[model samples]
Target: MERKNHIILSILAILLAFSFQESRAESRDSLFFEWYTTTNMEPWKSTMEQMAAERTPDNYNQLFEVVLAWYGYIGYCLGNDKEEEAEQYLETGWKFLDELIEMNPTNAAPHALKSGFYGFEMALARYKALILGPRSVSTLKTAASIDSTNIHYLVEKGNQMYYMPSMLGGDKEIALHHYKHAVELMISDSRYHQRHWFYLNTLVTLGYSYQSTEHIKEARKTYQKIQRIAPNFKWFNEEVWPKFVEKYGTF
Candidate 1:
């Protein structure tokens, strides 16, 4: 009877531990979602700091979330022209990404993220583009080859093609192809399109690509779709939409 009781207690203990972990995970997700909706960096920064401080092997996935959040924060800072703040986040983000890559060499996402960081660095220091540019492309290629279906890899590749000069083989048509493929892949998976910032950003990029190629009607329609899907996205609502209207008038 004592042996049976001990086994039951062990099972109960395991269940309780799992329940606690699940609760914590939910809390983290809630915090991240709040930050996402508000674009409030303080909450995200604090949450990431707490996660990093409490990190263990059991919470490696949470660490990845922190890294991805940091990447977004870096971009936010850069977009706001806060280069110093962006550089700070870039440094910390690189450390996390490097450790993650070391921990899982087979994971393509980290490689894609590192490639993006290099690209950001080049943007900050255009003089270094000659050196950092090739490295960025190489890392991205490695990531795509590792996981061709990864949405991040496809979006990054599309971004590279969209921004690169035409003389250097950047083709807006090819970029549109990549962006469309990425959208297709994301929409095919319900989990990917629902409240996913990356997917939304890809759509924005696709719209911009259309504008770059002088497809004003397509760009207007694309932006309109994004506004319908994510009306609260600040950049889309405040900046991109207003600029588009100013340039071409509302559709």
Candidate 2:
């Protein structure tokens, strides 16, 4: 009787672990969609740690998404002053990214993602910027050179260009060129259908790039385009655009 009870308890624990993993797997696609669409972290609040803890090098692209998702979530945490949480995500994200690049040494996308992660590290520890800043730029440029036409690479490069200060080599004009080329690539390519997360994400950044450069008219037009395509994008619709309207008044 005692032996049977012990076996039963062990089996139950194993089953519970498997169930948790399966649940995370089932929710991956939906949570990803919501992350970029709703831009709300509510669904992801409890999953970041689980996702990172389970990170494996088996599927290169799968691990890539985990790290990228971490990057996104970490950004939100940093912006909201959740320093401790952001640091945890940042450490795990960088570790996974390193593992990814080790396995896929020449992969451009991972390198691009690495560059972005470096930015997050710099944000959390400004003292590290001196070393990480140039590394960030070079890693991204290497990614772009490896695959100039990749929309993801272009968008990330543009992000670096658009957000970094001019003193640090960020130029809004150059960023615009990268963004316009990305938009053109996305439009002409059939792989990214309308409302695809990357598709919409590219446009969102392009809109912000326009705003940063004081091209209000172009920004408004971009906003209208997003409204037409992804009217329910809660991040832009509920938060970003409304704030823009409050400051600039709607077009």
Candidate 3:
């Protein structure tokens, strides 16, 4: 009877622990959604700090936590023209990312993100562009080759193609193709993409890519699509759409 009781207790303990992890993951997702909708960086920074403090094992949810933290702070720093500050965060992010990659070398997500990190590093130090640029492409190509349907890989490749210098073969057409393909893939898997942080981001990316490529009608349609889904998304509604509508009007 005691042995049976012990086994039952062990099963209960395992379930409780799993529940806790799921709760934490849900909390992180809510916080991330807030950050995305509002563009308020406090929750983003706090989440990164919390993840750093936890130093948790790289389970799927926690791995996403690491990625969110890594991208949030470093992207914020770069956008705010704080390259020096971004370097410190980048180093920390790279450490965590590398550890995750080492532990799960077969995981395509980290490889895709690592490719973006290389781009971010180049952004921080353009002098190293010649060295890191091809690395960024190769890393992403490897990631995509591993999983051709990986939305993250597709999006990262689009970013690389769109942002790389024309001298280095940046083609807006390639960006459009990749972005459109990713969006299509995401829509095909609503369970996978619904409320996924990057779903909205990819749509925004596509909209901007269309604008830059002079696909004015497509750009306008993209904006309308986002508006339909998230009318209250502050970043898109207040900042992105308004600025876009200023030139294009309510289309």
Predicted model with the maximum lDDT? 3
Q: Residue 79, candidate 2: how far off, in angstroms?
A: 2.0
Model 1: per-residue Cα lDDT over 76-176, one tens digit each: 78887899988887888888888888888787878888888998898789999999999999999899889977777877888888888999988888888
Instruction: State the C-alpha lDDT per candidate.
Output: 0.80, 0.79, 0.81
lDDT of 3: 0.81
Which segments of model 1 are wrong by more than 4 Å?
A: 1-37
- Using lDDT as the yardstick, the better of models 1 and 3 is 3
Q: How close is candidate 3 to the true structure, as a TM-score?
A: 0.87
Rank the models by TM-score, top first: 3, 1, 2
lDDT, model 3, position 54: 81
Order the numbered candidates by lDDT, best leading: 3, 1, 2
lDDT of 2: 0.79
Better of 1 and 2 by TM-score: 1
**Candidate 3 local lDDT, residue 220:** 94
TM-score list, all predictions: 0.84, 0.77, 0.87
Query: Compared with the true structure, what per-residue lDDT tens digits does model 3 show for residues 1-251?
Result: 99999999999999999889777776666667668777787778777777777866656557566765678678778977888888988888888788877887776778899998998898888999889988988888788778966887988989988987789789999999999999999898742354656677789899999999999899999989887766778878777888888998875
